[model samples]
Target: MENELTLKRFVDIRRNLGYTQVEFAKVLDIRNTTADIERGRTKLSGKVVAELLKQFKINPLWLFGESEMQYLEPSKTSVIPKVVTVDSSDNENMVLVNAKAAAGYPQNIQDTSWYKQLPAFDLPLPEFRNATYRGFQVEGDSMLPNLKPGEWVLAKAVEDIAHVSPNKIYVIVLEDAVLVKKIEKAPNSNNVTLISLNDSYPPYRIEPQQIQEIWQVNSKITFGVDATTEKGLLRQLQESMEELKNQFNHGKS
Candidate 1:
């Protein structure tokens, strides 16, 4: 089932955007019938959502209640970031890990030359220079909707794995593949489970010993989106709407 956009959320968005009901609807191409919904005559539709996001590059998470930030920065407005840089010691370089190299990261974690050969770019964020950061191009949908493929994610290196928090996402560097998954304590004391956001894929356990390196998922950097990105945005909206409807029904009863 897909998520839905709710009437309350619609009003919130209108107010947040500093637009009257009609004015917000105007931009969403729903100006005509928008009043109907406002007067308890109709409901917000997917078409309006499609137009809203495409026109304003609004973050679906915020619009649908998944995130508080509605307007994503231009660089990360889309599902993918064009470039990622890792801040180096002495505050000079941001390591850029391309997909090709990221696929082989586990094997090269201990290789000094390989790390140096990784591309470097300058990042202006002052906080980035404070500690080591690695940028990885997400290559799979295991962490879908929230973390999409082609998007860039930054994580700070955890010097000691003991401090890992439950249910937090982390980059697990394994020998053959590098994974971005949520961490949970496995049944086996010696192993840990790596969970995927997309429930279609089952959770699996892994021995921490197999992990060559781990980084906590910090921030996501997005570039831009296309026509197809609407599918994701709509899905998020639908899910939020479903929750809202359930709450309303529960209250009425």
Candidate 2:
């Protein structure tokens, strides 16, 4: 009963804390071992548990099953459940579209019937709750300092042309090719200009009618890893990424 209570408490805590196992592990200064905790195959040290109790002010009775207590006084807010359901077919060939693809334009090729035949594996998709992946591959060196050629980027599919923002990066399918570029809405017109991050390419404006599809890029969690022992490394990395983005924006301006 005590063990069951512990497991239940852990689940409750994790849910309330709004952390995926990976995020929770990072917060605990545990590197890449969240799966163990979730599986109940590993136990946290007494010191770590105590720290959690102290920091979170969790109900000890609920955690240890000393009493029928369920609620903690200083409660953490519940997180919205985010689940990613992948097709069952493409499990084995499930590749991370990390960089842009240098070959054929994935976005322009609308015949995804081939993908349906591949075995599928599901990953706990990242926290971009409102977005869906519209595949795009990298090309050229415009986004070079940050994105490399042959790396794949997952873009959020947008149905409306009005949804595309000015001066924001987007994955666009134009006729036979898909390209990633910064888009700027033309003043008082339906046309939009495509701008490349690299200065070697000249900016080109195109009418909305010329586009086949447009996708918004949300570049969070392009990589996955387990827990780590490094203190605040995740936080630091997030900050660094933000800083890099700002620097890129400044340079482009």
Candidate 3:
């Protein structure tokens, strides 16, 4: 029989704890074989599962798919806040919207079609629970290490413009485009500066009236490699390519 504690579930559980495969493997004191285990190509050695439960307070039943709850109880040393799906009574809803949601968000914010069609899930972060939240498929690397293309950012709706904080990430609505960028309060002006985390992309200033809606990005679900790591690799590759190009040009000269 296929193991209920499949590799996919293991990766999902690690992501829930905000740890990467390498980091989680380090915590478990496993030697350099976490990728295989996370890929389900291998299983834990004897006593490894017991050590994992002891170190991370993981619920064995939950890990093995025998239970729905994630953790047996709070770990005394755990500084991370525990999260669970919203109970059945509250109807906590979060719909994952497509990249086009940015362009159509203002129009479809009240519509049920997109909300119903997209994949939705619930989270229990108290600071964000009060607001209407949705997942937006982001694109472009302008935000760099903060937000990346093909990732879904969980954004909470901001009905009032005054509530936006300076230098915080926001999903801003425009007539033709929807963008995720940092907001910088301008000096004695009605406009706010939209900034990108990647320095290559320059900052832009726009009038608040141009903004149709605003949403605060609270969390993100990423696929493939982490953005920070990917960016570093890209930067290295770019530098190498430039050097190689320069050498070729010098040789030709």
Candidate 4:
């Protein structure tokens, strides 16, 4: 009976919120077919159940038919959690401003302008918590099995650079571009080194004074959607290689 309730209510709740099976699967990070779940053909794993509760705030009791709605209304004894939702389209319009780059990096490419606006959607935004904002496009396979290429991450902003700790990921805005790296302070200088989660890419150091600003990524609010497919991977690779060759030629000239 409890299992039945979990299956039935899970489908009902997601549909009520206007999410298609594919959209809901993406949100849950599940790589399964939605039809399997909806038709009760597949059993929900504890991990999947946990993800549903965490991502959507679905009530377990309610999902199991011990309660009324998919979510409980806040009451004297019930604690209401905050949720932040971000839409991809709104972020697409955000503006990127100018900043300095490293020396001998090419003057013409150093000072360029671009704009990106993030898509708008409603998610939980907790009040009284500090938020950091930085932009980065996923690059390598280190964070793979989680983040993929061409996916964008919007991180929360942190006020104190000195407060950064080890093993935590951060979205850093340097003089030239925004990056996602694990931050560690340099022993001798006021600079911090950005280490890639993937070991393949070597870490790079940048002076604290050189950075215009830094933003802590909001993992809960930060989500990635597919922008490229396997079929396009080769074309993307060719274009990237060509661009690198051009840059190399320009530097030698």
Candidate 5:
């Protein structure tokens, strides 16, 4: 059964790309669902083969089991050197990088001694457990309301460039500087688009080779807020709003 073997190879391709049936379906732009096709309820179409070639460069010969190679060209995946510090109990601690340290981070990233010297502490949060994380202090207004200056962002290391999801915020480590921005991958290209949330800034494209490392932003820790002053401001705003409402009602009456 040549057709059965082809179907099996097709399933293998999806698995190698780290996609589930549902995700593979979306990538293939399949209307009948990949689960149905995989189960032999629906036939795999020629369009799928062409799309796979265009997007991922899946080899037709390989898909049909004629060749041993899976892709015409190897997928471009980056392996970032992750250096983590462990506590006395053998648990990994999240490293803290201030503005000064962040500038030099790209150069010293691979050095174990350099990483150990940076401030490291165990974050008790369950979400950050069992993963290498780093806290970067936000510096600029590029991200605006979403991320503020002096706030610390906890991010997880993204090992592969292929795994960078579109429209997600990441701390991109470059040779010159480390930047925090939203990422968008250009289709069929090695260039990635960086978008700044602040309208004053414009989107820019950078080659994958220019990036040293990428970190997916998980959460932010904000400081320097006076809670009492904030509460008082809120009360004043509420009183002003009520006064405006009373004036409007009086005029109507």
Candidate 6:
């Protein structure tokens, strides 16, 4: 009986997504197993379940007959970026958005040729290996002593708005402007409050509809800073402190 319910629910998922059996299999990249599982000739495997969770944001408990909820929150759906550029090898390249291009980014973001014209490169870092990344030039003094003007911030696209972590900085793309700000979840509301590291700029709230894209700031690049300068030394110290905090959290977990 449990198996029957799970199989029925799985078919319902395909219908809900408006995908045929073949189409759903293509999306999950498991064409071989999809038909078998749907017909009850085989049981669903853990790997398939993981893929469904990662791709469709489907509620795992519900699929297993453990809960009544059929799906996770709609806000958890991953936002697929448009007009992404790729290298000759077909690997994704991180596109650079300098201050000049940023001004027109919001309006021309969907233009494929615009992305092609932007400078792009690939990094050998492990953390950046499996994700789409983009670089944005920092402008103004809004971020303050931590992120200086003219520095470049490399960020990965958030899988979903619901996955946005609080107290971290993000490069938020809006219809009219692009802003790099710290995020704070507004209590009991779908809107978010954008905060700044520098107290001079007051925090502001924005509705979800205003957000075009959200990229979590991962690391930064700056030139002409070495061990001899105060700014360089401060930057090193900050990196070290953050590394230590991460290590401590990992150990605790």
Worst 10 residues of 4 by lDDT: 75-84
The candidate 5 region of ten consecutive residues with least summed lDDT is 227-236
* lDDT values, one for every candidate: 0.65, 0.57, 0.64, 0.52, 0.77, 0.78
Error of 1 at 244 (Å): 32
Error of 6 at 166 (Å): 1.2
Please give, for residues 154-177, the per-residue lDDT of candidate 3 as tens digits. 777775565678757887766557
Give the per-residue lDDT of model 2 (tens digit) for 102-203.
233344244455344322223233333344554444766887666676444656667556567865678776655667888888678756789888888899
Select the stronger candidate by TM-score from 4 and 6: 6
Best by TM-score: 6
lDDT of candidate model 2 versus the reference? 0.57
Top candidate (lDDT): 6
At residue 119, give the lDDT of candidate 5. Answer: 66
Order the numbered candidates by TM-score, best leading: 6, 5, 1, 3, 2, 4
At residue 94, give the lDDT of candidate 6: 82
Candidate 5's C-alpha runs over 4 A off are: 1-81, 225-253
Score candidate 6 by TM-score against the native.
Answer: 0.65
Which window of 10 residues has the lowest lDDT sum in candidate 3?
75-84
By lDDT, the better pick of 1 and 5 is 5
lDDT per residue as tens, model 1, 154-232: 7777654555777678877776888888888745375678889999989998766666667788877664453134355
> Which of the two candidates, 3 or 6, achieves a greater TM-score against the reference?
6
Clashes of 2: 25
lDDT of model number 1: 0.65
Model 1 ranges with Cα > 4 A deviation: 1-89, 186-188, 224-253
Clash pairs, candidate 5, are none
- TM-scores, each model vs. reference: 0.51, 0.44, 0.48, 0.38, 0.60, 0.65
